[model samples]
Target: MLKKLGVLAATGMIMTALTGCGSSNNDLTTNKDTAKPGSEKAASGDTGLLNGAGSTFVNPLFSKMFSEYSKEHADVKVNYQSIGSGGGIKQLTAKTVDFAASDAPMKDDELKAAGGNVLHIPVTLGGVAIAYNLEGVKNLKLTPENIADIYNGKIKKWNDPKIAADNKGVALPATDIFPVHRSDGSGTTHIVTTYLNAAVPAKWTKEQTGKSVKWANVGTGAKGNEGVAGQVQNTPGSIGYVELAYVIQNNMTAASIKNKDGQFVAPTLETVTSAAKGALTTIPEDLKVKLSNQPGKDSYPIVGTTWVLVPENLTLDKAKAEKMLTMLKWAVTDGQKYAGELNYAPMPKELQDKGVEALKKVKVNGEAVLK
Candidate 1:
């Protein structure tokens, strides 16, 4: 098997001939003259850089970065596929991609199958916001339990008292509650379900923990964050969960979620940062962490962190892999600069340091992948 499958080549990409995962690295370059319009060169390299696949949630961010990076580092070309996290994980396990972006980290059994050298790099931080289009009643708030009940079909109307309870005097319209979900494998769904599993354990079990869930009600499925955002915006009394950026970009109304301390926390860069600050520095090598009911009183209970997948250990293709790591490392460091601009929180200094250490574990050419 060719291994590097599902990677789509961009037309008129103008990027230098990218290397690795079927992209030719030998022709990599750092010249803008080589890449197509909209792509910028970032690093000085001989072979065009190659990276692709995973997480539509991070798609806009990385797409922007890759385009900007191509200006100075035009020699390296970055191509990514928004094929959803499930496909990204599949491509990664099959050694088909240079890197895989995922909102949900890989599990222990998955790590073992990866054979030792997977680098779990959290590039940027964003929150999944509950967006809705209601008539007249704009200020909407929901506890995790309330959200759970809505998704579980327990509460069928937007004016349910459970929802109104959180809003106090806010008048919610008496409308049919329409819940839109992702049709594709999604980390956004994972984050939502994970929170649901915590706030409503009986409803959100292990079976419902991943991307797609079996809901008691029939909800329409949208393809990705963009689709869901559009669907929710156009449909009155419809609600959906997507990265905060989507909500902001789409100009949709976001619900304030109940925090661990019982305060309604609006999904924001600051609140998500507050939540991630509650996470520990010492996560297992597998990068799996349960994010629900965290200790921080300010922490938004529904917050989540995304992970990028790489080879388990350094490999003969270390140089190419380093291109992936270096890009990711840059995404975490400098990437945070743009995060706040895009409504994403920067990783805390503590976690940032730990993440740098974790990057060291991303090896190249049978040697520890260089710093």
Candidate 2:
């Protein structure tokens, strides 16, 4: 049965340190403004404040990108809330934020509820690391079946036969396996569930894919990527799925998941980028696509793309709209250089071009802002 763990007292310290790395107040501007081709000039006396929420999956990159953008434009300030993707979409629909970010593209019904003018502009690519807390185990290998069963509560011990089969030589403990998941709505949840659903359909049904799912009565729930990372960090024999950056930042142990090509791939910039190759060619015109379980020898199995959601026809004042679009355009273009350092993959040139084109559709009061 599922058992909930209390939020650990040390979790706050871990999150504080993790988020501190990308604090907006820190001026570490090292890049030039190369967005001149479609840049917008901030009007005099404009507050130039742009507020956004969503996608803790993209938080590190967003923290750096927004900070750098503000450095280049003194008048423009960006405040992004690293809430889960679901909360961000809700804020966007409620008109409480200027933009929203999510790893999972909004569903058609969600799009329709927001006046049907929203555009999904992909900003970064990353892997959902299957992080675990097991002593004396440095390298762990997992298959889709092993994962499906673990979360399904069918595999209750760390040394379960299914898990042991993948790591033949490793001495796995017989400790009870604890699975941690997002307690709130999250796009990270979407990416992991989507991968599980596709990789092992019979075990992880389509009904389980989305921003949130009724996980089997096993494991506990944590609030954000940091929360999950912390849960895994503090609990021995626990396993959780989190964005790759958090795994890196926390120095947590991650598993090498076997891909469709039968190769065990670790999450890296190259592997995550490789995961997008198949999807890039078949991506929809809306730019809404999934990159999990792609057919490539080098592709990481749990990768996903994060997008910034902006209304095609903005309701903000002309100045605010112009500045907001300008910053966003920069994010998808010049801002990409900062992604790799934070454990995220820069968008491929093809996807970057499409993102720019989508941003061009944004208008303020029927007048195009990018032109």
Candidate 3:
């Protein structure tokens, strides 16, 4: 399959893209000739630049969304860094970037440290797939116990009875199992840990749920989602959890995790959509909520929602703020059409309306930033 549009190579290249510009909005310039009537560029003569960093898990989707957005509104440019979620939050707190994207919601300490009040803008919903690179494996079924034991070092071999029992009649290998995990602070890690904690309380309880966790001695660590996916693809008998987009991009074998209904469900657009529908109903005023291990018969077990961090008050030039707001509004509305094509679950219309309401609250000197 063709690599999804705008999915760039990860690691150092991510930072290079951000710093190469000298500043986030520096290169943006008014394109008077290309401006459209009633368009954001027509209204605001300011250079249309929006800078964001964080969540390698969402990088591919954002890359597609932003690229398609530029096609429609030629004046605006968005530069996003695929650094780990921790780096994104740090840059946002320091006021060095226009916004930040995080898979995990900010902790209380992080919220207190922000130079300006931050708002959580929920973006697309997705799932974390437990994918493996076994030479002859096909359709692996992992129960809650099987997953817990594999990560906590209780199960060392691919042919372990617990895993075999879940997939009867399948040939099982006696090779040692290598568990791969994220080395960086990441929302993907948080979602996996959160699911583990809820699905297998006894083992995952000892390890707190966060972007970074203490892996059992048996597991190895890799940097970003791309790093983990690369390690799993190259190393046989290795299993790692990553967003569904990576699974699709790499064509790796994903495991079916046992859900709350006791059915082993694979991560697909339909299952993840079911999970999001059940979880998005009660989104709090803050818009920070986890969608993993949701209750539903067909729901995938390890789903999560990603958020874009924006300031409640616009401290940047009003033109820049308006431009940023315009592009963001487009992402949740018109930009949603590209989501399903990329294997991401678009927010439901009702929840999207609420998200738009939150975006409308952004203001400059106590007035709405975008008219």
- State each model's CA lDDT, in order: 0.67, 0.81, 0.77
Q: Candidate 3: worst 10 consecutive residues by lDDT? A: 12-21
lDDT of 3 by residue, 1-371 (tens): 22332443321111112211121111222112122212322134455767777787787678778877787888888867666677778878877668788899998889889855688888888889998989877788998778888988999999998898888988989999999988888889888888889988987883668998777798698766777877788788999997887777666678988999898888888899999888877878888877888889899989888888898886778878888888988887877877776678998887777778888899988999866
Clashing pairs in 3: none
Against the hidden true structure, what lDDT does model 3 obtain?
0.77
Candidate 1 per-residue lDDT, tens place, 226-343, comes to 6777788778778888777666654668887777787877776677777776675456554554555575667767777777776757443556666666777777776666666566
lDDT at 84, model 3? 65
Q: List the candidates ranked by TM-score, beginning with the highest.
A: 2, 3, 1
Candidate 1, residue 347: how far the Cα is off, in Å: 1.2
Candidates 1 and 2 compared by TM-score, better number: 2
Q: Give all candidate RMSDs, comma-separated.
A: 9.3, 7.7, 7.4
Using TM-score as the measure, the top candidate is 2
Segments of candidate 2 deviating more than 4 angstroms:
1-46
